[model samples]
Target: MNKSLSRLESALLLVAPLLMLLGGVLLVRYDDQGWDGVLAAMAAHPARSDVGWLLVAAGAALTVPPTAALAALVRARRPGLGATALVLTALGWASVPAYAMGGIVMEAMAHAPDRAAQVAVLEQFNDGRGNAFFLAAALGAVGYIVLAVGLARDRVAPAAAAVLIGLGGAGTLLVMAGPIRALLLVAVVLLLAGQAWTVTAGRRTAPASAVAAV
Candidate 1:
C-alpha cells in the first residue's frame, strides 16, 4: 500500500510539469507572448478575456500538487522536513496574489485601447505594490528550489528533476531585469521539461513499514 501510495504521489507530481508545459505552449501559440504578455492580452479583452483567465488559473492551480509531492517526500525523510516544506509551501502560496494581480494588470492593459485607462494602469504598475509580481516570480523560483532539494534528499524525486528545477529557478531569479528577462522566460521551458520528466518516470514504492503506518 505504501508503494502504491508512493506511485500515486509521483504521478501527481508529474502533473505539475505537464500542466506547465501545456500552459507555456498555450502562451506561445495564443499570444506569441510571454506569460505576462499573454495575461495582458487577455486583460485587454475583459469581457471575452475570461478564456485567458481560465488558462492562467489552470496553470497556477497546477503548481500545488507537485509542491505537495515535494512536501510529502520531505516528511517521509527528514525530522524537520515537514516544517521546512510548510515554509516553502507558504512561499508557493504567495504566488497567488501575484497571479491575481497579473490578471488585473492584464485586464487594465486590455483597456489600454483607450489611452486614459492605459495611463492609469501604467501608474498602478509603477507603484510599490507592483512588486507583487517580483514576489510571485521569486516565490515560484524558490518553491522549485525547495521542491528539488526535498525530492533529492528524500530519494523520491529524480536527480534530473532536481537539476531541472534548480536550473529553472536560477535562470529565473538571476536575470529578472530588462532584456535579461528573456532568460527568465526560458525558465518556463525548463520548468515544463522537468515536470514532463517527473510525470513520465516509473513510480517507486516506500518501505513496507512506512506503508503499514500510513
Candidate 2:
C-alpha cells in the first residue's frame, strides 16, 4: 500500500504541472480583455471565454492531488510546518473553482442586453465580500514561503525546488499587472519541476524510517 501510494503521488506530481501550464495558457489567451472589459470581451469572443474557463476549472481541480502529495512529503520531514503549509495552500487552491464560477457569470453577462446590468454583475464579482478570497491569497502567500523553507531545512527536496516555490509565492503579486500574470504559470512550472525532482530523489535517499513515516 505504501509503495502504491507513493507511485500514485509521483504520477500526480508529474501531471499537475502540465495541467497548470495548459490552464494558464488558456487563461492568458482569453484574457485579452481586462476585468473592466470582460463582458464586452466575452460577447466578442464567447468561444475563447468558454474554453478558457473550462480549462481553468479543470486545471484548478487537478492541482489538489499534487498539493496533497507535496504536503505529505513535507510532513514526513517536518510535521508542523508541513501541515500548516498544506492547509493554507489547500485553502488557496479551493478558491480557484470560484473564479471559474465567476466565469459562468461573465458568460451570462455577455448575453444580457442591458449594459448597466452587466457592469453591476461584474462589479459584484469583483467586489464581493467573501472572506475566502482573502484567506486563500494571504494563506497561500505565507504557506508557500514556509513550505519552501521547511523543505529546504529538511533536505527533502532540492534547494532549487525551495527557490522555485518561494518565487512562485512572490509571483502572486504580478496578478495586478494582468499581462504579467503569466508569472503564475512560470511559478507553477518551477514548482512542478521541483516537486518531480523531490519525489524521484527522495525515494532513493530516504531512509527506511523516513519512508515508513511518510
Best by lDDT: 2
Residue-level lDDT of model 1, residues 1-214, one tens digit each, is: 1232445555544554454434333331222124345445555456444443344345556556655655665666553654565465556545543444455555655544665555455456545675665565566556556767766766554788767866764453333322332454587567656655655654463743676789
How far does residue 187 in candidate 2 sit from its true spot (Å)? 2.5
Kindly give the number of clashing pairs for every candidate: 4, 0
Model 1 bad stretches (over 4 Å)? 1-16, 25-50, 93-97, 112-117, 169-185, 203-214
Top TM-score model: 2
Which parts of model 2 have CA positions greater than 4 angstroms off?
1-5, 28-36, 169-179, 200-214
List all candidate RMSDs to the true structure: 5.6, 4.1
For candidate 2, write residues 115-148 as lDDT tens digits.
Answer: 8766765556555754456557667667778778
| TM-score of model 1 vs. true structure | 0.64
